[model samples]
Target chain A: MTDPARAALAITHEPEGGLVLVLRGELDLAGLPGLAPALDDVFALPRQPVVLALDDLTFLDSTGVSLLIRIANHFGTVRTRGAAEPVRRVLEVLGLAGRFGLGEG
Target chain B: MVTSAPRRLSILVGVVLLLITAALSFLAWLAHAESEENLLRRQLAQVGTLLGSQATVLQVQLADIGQVAVATDGNPSAFAAFADRQLTETGQSLSLWRVDGDDMEQVALQGVPPLLPDGGADRLTELEPDGRLVMFGILPGEPRRLAYGLMPGEDNTDFVVYGEAPLAPNGRVEPAEGSPLAGLDLGLYLGEDAAPEQLLQATAPVPIEGRTETTSVPFGNSTLTIVGASQGPLTGIQSAALPWVVLGVGGLLALGGAATFEFVSRRRAEAERLAAENDRLYRQQRGIAGTLQHALLPAVPELPGLEVAARYVAGEDELQVGGDWFDVIGRGPGSCVFVVGDISGRGLPAATTMAALRFAVRAYLAEGHTIEDVLARLRGLLDIETDHQFATVLLGDLDVPAGRLRLVSAGHFPPALLADGEVMLVDCPVGTPVGVSPSVADSAVTVPVTSAATMLAFTDGAVERRGETIDTGLDRLRTAAGGVVSRPLDGMLDDLLGALVSPGNKDDTVLLGVRWG
Candidate 1:
């Protein structure tokens, strides 16, 4: 595994067996350049249920929001399931969490 | 890249070229004139040499005593002997002669006619007497058209010969073979009526200097006159070369001038285009900032029975558009809901967070949530909805009939109290900025509408900044709110915003004011 400073993804698995991603800065047109690789890792994992937490995220713009929606839409519940409360809220605000079946179910 | 240097260099080069061309043209013209002068001078020298040779021949023949006496006394035998000797020695053509005596009588010797023609006797009698012989007549019956005359010498009693020689080619005489003037026109003339100045003036001036030479040679017994004039007009060859040189140089100069003009004009056009583009980009950046600020704020919500007024001011600096917002919701029965919030940070992200907070407050209020419950729910909603972006807000419900105001403060500034021509700050407990935590603790404060006249709620940016602390802003806000408390609430809001929030406020400032009788 390669470690790059502020490399687009910084994920730490919590003691409760959930993944917590700390997105400290902003996600704008500039930040979109390296986000694809991190998101790919999330979708390529096994079908086991996992909580994708975005609690440490300080800023998320429309570009970031759109990427989240596209991930959930493309990978329906059969392959990917469960997400943290904050991430679910962002998806609901964008009106896509229900379609992906990732909230409360 | 400095255009002026190249431009000046080009201009300097052009001036130098102009001066050089002028000097060259003047020199060329001088050379042309000099060439013509050389041609004329060579011709004159040749003519002078020929005249010298002719005079020597005549002088030798005249020195012969036999030939002179025979020609003067009209002796055929002596003339025949002299003519035979001259033919054998000099190979010259023997010509006409006239003799004058001391008695002013003249005689024609051999080589003259045997019988006089109609006007021949008068012509022969016209010679001068006293041994100063004079002769002048036109020869006839020959293609050469030669004329000859002889006058006697002053003291020696000898005669003089005057003559017009035949033209070699056309009317001009030709120089001898291998002469410097062999191909030139040597039109020499000598007489009292001939003007030397007129001939000299006909030729163009040239720079050559050798003084005129004079030599006297014998002709019969009198001296033959010889004068050389070196002058002639410029030939076609010299005069024709100027126009062609001028045309060629002038065409080159015109082409260079036109190209330089076009290059300068094109650069000027490019400069104008760059300036216009810069102006357009500046304007577009300004518009983008303004749109972001507008998007974050709430549209003014209409509330019944309560005179609610709000004003928002955006900073003037280009990079400083921010997130400050206010909203009023009508809660039915002469009561209404009001809020003023400030999102953390500046620019677009702050604006987005403010938008979420504002809508969340309005939605909770519409669902019949109490003022305190609405604040709690809004805190929870933002904690979940936003990443870490937070908003500081004050939410209140006004009961117009009950004459009471209930409010929940989430780390927001306390409201300003206006009463009896004085302004005071209403004391309230502060809470943490909303969305900082999932469970934010908030404090509810209630103030009676009795004798309070007007209440003003505002974001920190309305009366605060980096220089002035929160207390100083509160004091300034209180003073401003005192003057307008007696007037209508909407006008008072305008006056307060006009006084404290804008034209100079360096951040987005949101203000909401309400009054109840």
Candidate 2:
């Protein structure tokens, strides 16, 4: 029953001292409650530059897009890695590709 | 009305629960009564066993007396000594008799004088076999005497010994202190029937009453009937109260269940009513909003050498007054200004913002503001952060005499142009949607219009689908418009909408069309 709202997350510190957060499964309103603590911990990390891995993310909605926007707006040095085409397109249409360092979507 | 249904349901449930409680209570009571009856029978059985043993003891004593009579050759002194230890009460007797056929004569008498009549059959020896112990039956006295006789050895039928025991006056005997039969009302009758005259002793009156247990115990050759009834509950107070307790608790539980059912049903009905009321109100609001939006829009003005047509369709699932509107103003002979705009959200706030933007645009154009300046001025009417809304608009000026057209866009879909029977999307730069950012970089582009060319501009609702690229929707719109552009302007616009608008669209849409010669 909780599987739909279930999110599996992994955080790894890169050799170059950057933190990469991997997101998997659905990312929607229902998953937000369980994800809030993880997000808070990420915001507290000393690392200024953060990389997001969205290759495993199966779904994203407006709320998920809002969270991404908040993350990009927070850390100017943040960049997304392996964002899906649909994910990139949403950011592109909102004209936030430059903010997330995904040029021309 | 809601109360009526819950009340009816509760009544039905209550009746069913009450019936179940009654049935359970009755069964428990029956079982308790059965156990009580069994206990009474057991008590009577115990009394019968004790009395039967007493009868055996009497026979033994009488046989001993008979032996003494034989040893002493019927000496009266020997008989008196044995009889002295055998008599139990003041109104009792013991004697030794010589049985000659059916006539028995007493050899000695001890205690009270024997009640046997002279010259009468001993009755004890008449029916009983030679040496068997037998009942002599009751004798009349202040207190009745119960007599028994035993001849002893079968070889000797001549000598017989008889004994008698007294009963209480009025057939009532006070139970001994601490007697086990203390809790019972008991009656001991001489025979199977508890006849008043045959009752030898009793704790209560002549006959025990109410659910009595009757048991028979052997007394010499006859049987004594012991009839008994419990003075109170045989198994104590808790057992007596158990059935009532079950009934009480069952009744409470049945009531509780019915009340809970009523509460839940009432709550559900209330929720349903509230939901229906909300729906009715929502539809009413939508109707007013639709009417208001139509009133705010201008009637299409006819222009010389030009054809104009437009449509406004509210999405099936869209809020009543979402921001979608179109305007066409006749500027003079062979020229007109057209506008198509869409606001981002829904409801009264979005509708109000849309109205403000529309009137502002009309004022700007009426003041002779250039199409580019007019599109730019629309930005000042709203701020997305404050209103949480933005408008995507397209404006065009068409001149049929010069076959020229000018177009400007504010983050809106590019207008479709059909010229020489070829369909193409206008190459126009889209500015940031108005009210989104403080300042936007934009301009107007003029393109020469071919003779009798038709141009269509519309909102994203005409092509927008969730999770899909807007370009695919645009391509679809372009193809659809191309197929129907050959028809008259009104038919063309209607067909395009029929082809492009899907029922699942949740945003209102507006389409503006202009045909120039």
Candidate 3:
């Protein structure tokens, strides 16, 4: 278990014409507000393939998954890289692994 | 906790303050009394000094005249001139007397003629040799007088310098305005005792009275007794009223302190009473919520050839009951339609919404609609915007003898299937939670199981927790169900609940289980 308020994020430009957003720490209801400004920065970009880096992520809930679904519906092509086993399991059980291109539960 | 506790505390504070005020006032009064006595004593001493000073002035004047009498060898012209200066007041006299054996003669006189009778001259002859100075009271007459005689101190001096002065008007010697004894009622008397006839001078009439003090000062061959009393307080007005001031101010402070103490104490008691009342009301509302929650729940159906048991746990937090329920309807022999749904929020609104949806499910299922249709129909029952709530449900049409289950999920978790001592969480296609929009469940996922398989469907309360993943909880449930799968359905469900429900879980949990019998 982790506190979502201390959640951290980093942005990197990719040479393949996309933006990579890295997220760390527990992402929960209490931690969502801290990411708003950063999310706004991403929202300003036009139709770029967004890559999510979730290797260091420790926790995920239905609300957090709903947000990921919104991101998938927003971008041209959204891809998740190095997702942890627990995060993949929730996405798989909610039948969204195919949508986000995360293989297996 | 006693009803009178605050009142008793106030009384205690008041008594303490009153005692303190009394003690302070008493001390101030004591100081006042002591200084008053000293003041009276000091005034009486001044009166004695006044009388003695007058006597000294007379002796000094007479002694000078005696020197003149000896130097002039009893010359009348020189004596008259010097003696006239000594008679500074009206009705006064000075005389030169020659004393011989058993006789006396007035050689010279000045000012008023002597008012003494024949015995007065004889009394001067009685003055012995070496007499310093002598003063005697003359017998009572109009405007009484005192006579003084001084034989010259030198040897062989037969001439005596004598003087007489009548008392002032009414025998009252009014002290000068700024004198130390100005504000005093005073009396001076010859000799120690204050005899009426012996009164020499007085400010007050006749006898001095009212808080009087007496003292004595040396006079020629005798003493003058001085009696005095103060006309007003010796100390200033503030000091005179000091004791009353202390009492008045201290009394006010005492009452203020007591009143403040009573007010605070009563407030604390009132606050405590309100807190207890809130606690009682909270418990009462929780009790009512529990009763209402149970009354709205549907009893599990008794289907032939199937063993079923369901459990519901109310959350221990908030006064309102959570909205989570499970229902099982028997369709035919060894067949049943079971539905498990969870509302997103709580209280009467969530509970009413849950009730409406649960009833709708029962109605549609009785109409021989498929499990997918039951889930799709719920979308029309509620809208998240109007009701401020959403619901997720797991609906299943189970074939107990056939060991087959058809499941449809609306944003709900798949049920766990246990058979031959193996546990598996079914992978039903998840859809949007009901109430988000008017949508249809277009897919129904069917999974086959062993004849002895038992299935358990539950709400998210069984697995979801903050700061962790839901899969961790799902794993725990699977492990627990594998261990208890061989037991009777009711006993197995109890074991699973005890093992999987964490002590920190405050969310409501609903566990619906069905086993092939």
* Off by more than 4 A, model 1: A1-105, B1-153, B156-158, B172-302, B317-321, B343-353, B370-390, B400-404, B408-412, B429-440, B459-461, B464-474, B501-506
TM-scores, all candidates, are 0.54, 0.77, 0.69
For B1-517, candidate 2 gives per-residue lDDT tens digits of: 8778988898789778988998999998898899999999998898899888988887778778877887887889989998898876687778777777657677888988777633244564653434456776777776677777777664544677777778778778788878866889998888778888888889997567888888998877788998899999998888888889889998998899899888888999899889888889988788777777878877877888778888888878644667788888888888988888877666676677778988888899989999989977888787654665667788888887777788887767678889888888888766656764422356878888887788888886787666666677788998898788789999998998889888777667788888876
Q: Which candidate is the best by TM-score?
A: 2
Arrange candidates, best lDDT first: 3, 2, 1
lDDT of 1: 0.55
Candidate achieving the largest DockQ: 3
Write out fnat for all predictions, comma-separated. Answer: 0.00, 0.04, 0.25
* lDDT to native, each model: 0.55, 0.76, 0.78
Which window of 10 residues has the lowest lDDT sum in candidate 2 chain B?
B117-126
Ranking by TM-score: 2, 3, 1
True contacts kept of 3: 0.25
Every model's DockQ, to 2 decimals?
A: 0.03, 0.13, 0.22
Compose the digit string of candidate 3's lDDT tens values, residues B1-517. 6448988888889889988998999998889877877888887887678668888777777777877888898899989888888888888888988887778888899877787644757888767656467876654666888777777677888888788788865569888999876998878788877888888778888688887888898887778888888787777778779989998999898889889999999898899898888988877776666676788887777779888899998866556677788888887888888888887666666687787888899899889889888877888787655665667788998986676899988778899998878999998788767755422344888898777778999987788665566777888888899899888889988898888777757678899998885
